[model samples]
Target: MASSRGGGSQQVIRTGDMEKMSLDQLKAVKEQADIEVNLLQDSLNNIRAATGRLENASAALHDLSLRPQGKKMLVPLTASLYVPGTLDDADKVLVDVGTGYFVEKTMAEGKDYCERKINLLKSNFDQLIEVASKKKTLADEAGLILQAKLKQSSPSS
Candidate 1:
């Protein structure tokens, strides 16, 4: 069987084709399949990271919205340290608009923005998961085919 990946169409080795390929050809095909799996894994990792970030942002915004206005709280100066600060207005927040830009929005608007961004990130994450699963299935099939071919050629068998 064959699959059309982006850029061009490529042949996938089936049980029948695997029986005809030389040992070297089988190894080459296996290597290509491994590469595809690796690329898909990298993409999945990136999406996972983005999803985590969006979730964290959403949590922070929600927590901020619940805090009392004019209350002094510890603001995170670093991962391990927080400086004392006062919440002048729980009604507003600073939001990162990407490309090193930030925008001010009301707390309600900020929550809405977080919800929208989280939804977008989740959608991308789901797509990446689907692609990665397909690539992994392809890699596993290729590995099985290669193993069967190797076994057929073994003298002990």
Candidate 2:
């Protein structure tokens, strides 16, 4: 009896009798499967490397979050003088310790640093995305090759 495969090809193998594939057909199938396996491995490796980079960036962010926000330093004023009128000498010696000002400056610097780091992380993420896209293309090509090989090897219908 004649049987038809899905791709408009006909084969004359009997319905009840199963025939073994030729050595070349078996080798072709094996090769197609190997290509699929290799493509999958490469995709996995790309994903792993991307994940590692993201993890490292996350760790750096965590470290930045844990950093001290700067402490104010106490400055003593020493002056031997007296204001005989209204304000006392101690009151007149109310000096700006400048700690608050310096803290604000330092915080600004830290913010700039964090921004730069975030930009770098974003760039790395973009690179990872590009890598993933390339891997996906490779995987798709491998899948198509396997499908075509399988279709070619199948009994025609």
Candidate 3:
């Protein structure tokens, strides 16, 4: 077996000719690799869950935006001002309960939910970034240790 050297340099290692590594060195390398892999997996899972919530929130917002807002009402109430095309079909008119209210309550609720989802996604992203940084540091350290071991095992040229 063969492996490339650190920093994408020209050096290479031929494992077959290398002397056997000590038990402690092997165990240390294994532990470092395991930590990096576990952190990466956790980051992946967090991003996946955050993305799902974002997609759901975005879909709800889109659906709300497409709702029809111009339709005449069959039953006219004196207190409410009926705005034509408020409902999806011709049967329902948009009714304003006295005070020039243009707010879509459902849409408002959806926006709130979307905001919350976005905050959660941002938090997850930050966590993933932190984890990724730690993984990189550990991986770099492991690579250095492994390279040192390989050099020690190699015949002095």
Candidate 1 residue runs with Cα over 4 Å from true position = 1-21
Evaluate residue 143 in candidate 3 and report its C-alpha lDDT on the 0 to 100 scale: 60
Between the candidate structures 1 and 2, which one is better when assessed by lDDT?
A: 1
| Number of backbone collisions per candidate | 0, 4, 8
lDDT of 3 by residue, 1-157 (tens): 0121112342322333222546475556547556655656666676677667667656745654665556343333443753433455422223222377643445556566556766776675666566556545655555666678778779999
Name the candidate, 2 or 3, with the larger lDDT value.
Answer: 3
Clashing pairs in 3: 69-85, 69-86, 70-84, 70-85, 70-86, 71-84, 71-85, 71-86
Candidate 2 backbone overlaps, count = 4
Pick the TM-score winner.
1
Among these predicted structures, which one has the highest lDDT?
A: 1
TM per prediction: 0.76, 0.36, 0.48
Error of 1 at 41 (Å): 2.6
How do the residues 1-157 of candidate 1 rate in per-residue lDDT, one tens digit apiece?
Answer: 0122221455544656755777787677667767766775676676678668867887898898888888899998667999999999888788888998989999788878878887876776676567556666666766777788778778993
lDDT of 2 by residue, 33-145 (tens): 45544554555555456556545544544544454434232332324543333221221122122364422223234445445655664565555455445444544444455
Alpha carbon lDDT at 154, candidate 2: 91
Mark the 10 consecutive residues where model 3 has the least summed lDDT: 1-10
